[model samples]
Target: MTAEPPLLALPLHAAAPTGAPAARSFTTQLPGDPRALYLSRVWVRRIVTVLCWRGDVLRAVEAVTRLVDNGVRHGIPSSVPPPEQQLTLSIATDDTGSLIIDVADLNPAFPDFEAAVSGERGCGLWQVASLGARVTRFLPHEGRGKTVRAVLAPGPVGL
Candidate 1:
């Protein structure tokens, strides 16, 4: 039986008052489980919706899950998943006010964007890029994994 993993919710900081320089954001750390992916997707969608980034919800969530899937699959062993590789999902705005969706995992070997886009096997991340999610940057953890960040700008909602 799989033990339920813990969920960590950060302080709500998604929206800032007009003229404020620092934009708010929301963060949640989840386990490397399918259920965790679902929860994270829902939670992020809500934040995007509330922030009026309606156009970004679907694409942002899509990229979030794809990143989570890659993270869990490669970072955690299927037979014995580790909490150390817990998925971290965060939604915030950059200094420029663009919506940012960040997902991190304990995998040092990040996704190969070139292969994902050109090879048939690596279509997941390709799809993310195809949706116009700008891969902002990749931040390495102290000595373990890395966080892949993608940005989505507010626009018309997608059908």
Candidate 2:
């Protein structure tokens, strides 16, 4: 059998000094396709791994997976023009060091927010909240769509 390729090591990112928050953000636009869900997970994992944040990377990946899936399913309108049938994913760190994950999509309606937050709706949002993320959403100033944002506390939860 052919030898498998050796694993590649990720470069080390210098840790931000204590009390000095690092502000960085990454954003990408993905088409409203089921395939974009996979891209979302990969994006979160790669970013988390590269940043070396203290929070659990898997948790972030899981949360992002659900959010992107929701955007692709509920946020993309079948009647919308092709140019407007995509969503935006963003990851950033706030001044308090919390990791923020935001997914913005074309549909402004999110009628199940309450149900989802309460676990009454099965959108996997409750699971994200159970992972210690504070999930919330807002409409952009232009009011074309909504953005679902989940903030993960710095460091792993349940400490």
Estimate TM-scores for all models: 0.71, 0.80
Off by over 4 Å in 1: 1-22, 77-81, 117-121, 141-143, 156-159
Per-residue C-alpha lDDT of model 1 across residues 52-129, encoded as one tens digit per residue? 664656777887777777666765544445545477777776456567766766665645655664445577666766
Cα lDDT for residue 35, candidate 1: 73
- TM-score, cand. 2: 0.80
True-vs-predicted CA distance for residue 69, candidate 1, Å = 1.7
lDDT, candidate 2, 1-159, per-residue tens: 222222233211222222434377667777788867877777778777665667888889988888888898889888898776888887776567778788888888999797997799884788888888888888876658888888887777883
- Model 2, residue 151: distance off in Å is 0.3
Write down the worst ten-residue block by lDDT for model 2. 4-13
Cα deviation in Å at residue 117, candidate 2?
1.1
